[model samples]
Target: MRLALSGVSVRIDSSPIVAECDLTVEDGERVGLVGPNGSGKTSLLRTVYRALDPFAGSVALSGDDVTTLSQREVARRAALVAQDSTPDFDFTVEEVVAMGRGPWLRAFESTTGGGDATITAALERVRLADHRARRLSTLSGGERQRALVARALAQESPLLLLDEPTNHLDVHAALELLELVKDLERATLCVLHDLNLAAAYCDRIYVLHGGRIVADGPPAEVLDPELVRTVFGVTCTHLTHPVTGGLLLAFSPQQPVRSPHSVKG
Candidate 1:
């Protein structure tokens, strides 16, 4: 599948949050969206997933414009793992995963034995099968994040959109989720805060700044020290991970680097 955002712009309260941005995820490719806080990474995502419509440009899935499709058709084409929780209906984990099948349900066919199996498999894939009976609201923040992912997994869509999926996960869980993303044969556009994780898992990375795409390319090319220092306002040391061979971004909080010539004796 292919996902494309062409010169998309999003606004809230009649003010633009994202502007004229074009991005793409080709078949079986994983793309990362990264930027500083309030840079509008999520705003672009919201446009693609149809939670927010773009006032300009277009979002297309497999060459078909999303705005032209019905809501159910859109859901069948793409699944979103958003940061915030869905409205709480006091559902269990199993129930939450099963709800993902709603888009596929036929009229008057509310439940099925196969649906239950699908839900079980989704939970198991995320290592939450044992917690299936637990209340969705009661899961820890990380666990809830996993449940959200499990819901998207069960949707079985060819296009995946994720926003901050690893926000609250522990190290192991975070890695586990990224591994799942890497293994999936789908077009993925994910919003990620952890640059190292994006470098490790994503095939390409796009950096947004001031609501524009400031930089984009392979992780190795886009994550240079100069770009990191300028766009992120921090110093960085770039190196390859000897074990996995991915880019590792070591950063320092914004601070002045004293020059020898400027130092007084």
Candidate 2:
């Protein structure tokens, strides 16, 4: 499914966060959102998932206005695997995954056999099949991240909203998550901090600064060293990766590197 944000602005307690911005994730594309701290990347995602409504303009899914749909209706179309989304209590892994079916369940309806099957399959997809009976709180951070992803998968939504989905994972696990998302046949809007990973996996990228889109295009076009220095206030050695032939970035602080002997010793 396609996601379009047209002239969208967001505010918090009367303070503007995101200005009128136009962005889109074409059908079956994996789009990346990248920016420095406080750049409103997460804020824009919240607006897309309807957690926070835009102060101006609109967000549409597959050409339908999201505002026209109820929250449950929206859940049926978009599943958010956010950075801070954790279960309130100690729910079993399967139980947590099954919650993704909330949008499909009617009031007073219990989960049917097929629902159990779906949850099981979701766990397996995320490689957590053996942990199905484990308490969600008992898992490590990376394990927990995978379980949450499994929950989103169980939702079976066309548009997946992921805000830093690799936060708690180690390097290998982080790469694995990106690979998994790339293999998915769904539209994904992911907020990523690592520029190299963004370049490796995203079909396109949008850079945000001070609540507005500063630059956007394919990873190579948008992640130029000059743009990185300007927006992120950091210098980077940008190059084509020798192994993957993708973009490679090594960042440093804006100031010149200090020599150990130059400092008072």
Which candidate gets the maximum lDDT versus the true structure?
A: 2
- TM-score, one value per model: 0.91, 0.93
What's the CA RMSD of model 2 in angstroms?
A: 3.2
Model 2 TM-score is 0.93
lDDT of 1 by residue, 128-161 (tens): 9899888988887777777887888888888889
Which residue runs does candidate 1 get wrong by more than 4 Å? Answer: 112-115, 257-265
lDDT of 2 by residue, 1-265 (tens): 8899999999999999999889999889999999998999999999876899999999998888888888998998999999888988998888888889899888977653434777888889889989988899899877888888888988989899999999868998898888877877689999999888899999999999989998999999899989999898889898778998888998888997788989885
Clashing pairs in 2: none
Report the number of backbone clashes for model 1: 0
Which residue pairs collide, candidate 1? none
